[model samples]
Target chain A: MKIYFPNFFQALLLIVLFTGGSAAFANEKSFIDEIKGADAPFDNRSVKLVRPVTLETVLAKEEYQGGAFRVLARKQHIERYKCSSCHVPGKPVLVQQGFELTHGDVVINHGRKGNELSCIDCHNQEDRDYLEDKKGRKIDFDHSYQLCGQCHFRQKRDWLGGAHGKRVTNWAGDRVVYNCASCHNPHSPRFEKRFPATYSVPLN
Target chain B: MGFTKKDKAEKIIEDVLEKPSSRRTFLKGASIAMAAGSAALATGCMPSGDDSSSGEMQLRWQEYFKKHYRLMTQKEKDETVDRLERLAKIQDDIDVQIGTEPPIENVLYGYAFNISRCEGFMECVTACVKENNLDRKTNTQYIRIFEMEPGKLDPSTGDGQFYHKVPVENKFYMGVQCFHCENAPCIKACPTKATWREPDGIVVVDYNWCIGCRYCQAACPYFGRRFNWGKGEVPKEELTTKQHYLGNRKRPMGKMEKCTFCIQRTRKGRLPACVDACPTGSRVFGNLLDPDSEIRYVLKHKKVFRMKENIGTQPKFWYFID
Candidate 1:
């Protein structure tokens, strides 16, 4: 009995500490709830206290339209340019076999001089429909923001927080925002310089 | 009796009294004038052959005697709206829907302009003109987008009428409109109390009550107000039929008009036309009281400034650089 008594006291001490810690946590949670309830006066449309951004939340998958957020795949946008129609299923090598006949008119002026990226760098070799991320993960065309977010983290954060990107339909109701692909082309991401709308009045 | 001097003076006075200069004659003329005035008021100048002339006369009298929009009863407001709608149909041959939506409780409308995003597109201005049905004849544009060279924040130095292709190197764009100031000087300067700020922070002018004094226009430092020099000549196809009682309802000549933040649309939980028309997503508008709203987010997260902040207008509109 003497030998087990000290061990028993230690076990009891641990249990007390655990219960006290959990009780304090529960108290904190209820306090937050009380604050939220008090803040909302009429409709439950009080300003939500936004949590601080974390790497995990930034990298999390986006949910849109009651499904996973998606962008139109490259193949879908250009229906006329089908790889299966030109190249056979087994033939992975197509550069030497009359590449100029099909893609001669295509202009690829993207990227800096000498380090211009090729189509194969971002596109999946086996499946022409899918895009390959840096880690070789096949990504849906709709979730192209993910591919862009890998490099442009700041823009991604802004887009998520209603700072960047265009919101459509109504601002008061459902938050249906456009994806990065909707505004910019993946091959040419930079916005083109164009003539603006008609002027309000003639300049003096 | 004729031989005496006093008798002669009395005879001359009687002669003058017998003429039209007598007090009785004056009283008779005054009664005739009163009767004519009353008749004019009752029948509206001249009797018309039209079937709706009586109804029109009654409507005009009612409109003339109607109280300010703020003091009007619910029933009175309804009757006025109906009359105005009918008048629009008769005069312009266009169906206009005028809403009397009261201010939403706890909703103080706020606007945020993003300078970094605005490319001097003028899309917002065009959309605003079409939506508000501004007078195209005088080229009265409520929104004036200023193109400023970098390093200069002063609007005075910016050119509001730049015609060159935009996104000009080292130049930024900023748009200005009626701020709907909390301490609106226009309201104070109005000699007739024609203009006042609504509960939702929208400063509105009663078109019928304004006397073309231009006091409000002179009082405004931002030059946001516009005076109608002539009747607004809106084409039948161009006229915006959807309107509000205190908003875009077509104004008569010689009345002050300004942007009401698209009250007809905004009060119905829709965005202002400018906000919708902005291709660059430069404009943000919402209830300032609501913490979760987009305007609140922009106010909290962005570095915002009100134009002429030193004037102490306490404008609800804010400008920000990205």
Candidate 2:
């Protein structure tokens, strides 16, 4: 129909088309944005907050083996450090160093027989200071995790991944955790059963 | 004994009745209006010294009318938290810091308990009670450690009160608290909207908004909620001064409360008191969304299961064994 139309009608048609096109454009862009947003993963490191209470220092930490945590150094907390001060090479040490005198209360019951694994198996006999791994590699007292990691590799892997051991004080920031000895008595690894601190049947 | 407007009006009526003169009736009506005006004036100029009367009456009034914590603006939250701390100082003489830190963005908390590792020491129980300031008189613990036998994963079939020794022969220990379920039934059951799961997945209760109806208590299948039957009694010395508005500040009597995963500590990047207190290192808590977190490792690598998966609660809590 070749009927004449006012100029206003033509402009109105353009406005309608442009408005509808803009809406479609926005929807198309928004759909892509939604997909991208869903794909983007959130990282825990985005949290900048650190633990207010910590027993760890940056001076002594090893980034957890390919993990997102740091293991706190243990040597600083070790009692009777500098094993060399009390022991000479090829000499009996536990008695002379007052290790037995001071720790007279503790008994080493880790293995079935004491002969299977002696102090020198883990503790360096040649150098009373550094701990010895199974391969006779000298491990720093601070890094005794490497020593414990040998025999109890499963626990070591979990500890490194932060499933088997204790986190120091807080959960976030500079993720520093306690070494194996912090919870387990290295000499006597098994925990003793004891009475609960508070006991009440919660269920009525 | 306080001079209220009603008391003043009663006195004015008594004086008018004692005379009973008909001519003064019109004047009595006029005088009553005057008394009303004066009563308003008197109250407007009331002494500031009355503020010292326990400070609780004022706090209680504000607390009574407060909006649900989720609906409150930051400013309103701050005002209430300040009033609560001041009330504690005035009434109990204990200086408490009530934190109102909101959930961190993009973080969802999840907890994992190692069934193979928990030794039934109840260290978590002791730490939870001390940390949350639970009722000393009643010993209302939020976390219950059940001594379970083989093939019995249910709490009803277990013993929560084997006090003789932990890790009993042929038995394993299981600790149950609020799993902070993804689809929490308690939140759905609450008539007042007092309890809700935060963005971080830790279900919290606004202490003031709770109506003490205990509907949530009845609705929770895991027995995750507790009703304060009596006023929580913690010795002034034993009370934990560090508190959270939605956590273990000071619970009102008859409100439903459950484990908030130690919101005061957790929101600040600290582990829950129970996790920190465990001698066996069984409890693991972290951001659920974070793939590298210990909890995620436990979920992905270990044979893990929730308490009642068939109910479709989708609890963030999981139990695993070595």
Scoring model 1 with DockQ, what do you get? 0.11
lDDT of 1 by residue, B135-238 (tens): 88887888889999888777779988778777888889989899998768999899877888776779988887789999999999888899887688878798
lDDT of 1 at A164: 63
Q: Which stretches of candidate 1 lie over 4 Å from their true place?
A: A1-125, A202-204, B1-49
DockQ of each: 0.11, 0.27
Give residue B131's lDDT in candidate 1 (0 to 100).
Answer: 90
Model 2 TM-score is: 0.80
lDDT score, residue A166, model 2? Answer: 68
List the lowest-lDDT window of 10 residues for candidate 1 chain A. A49-58
Tens-place lDDT digits, model 2, residues A99-172:
54555656778777835567777888688779888788988877778888787889887877767986777766
lDDT of 1 by residue, A123-194 (tens): 677776667888888876656777777778777765665566645534444344566766666677666666
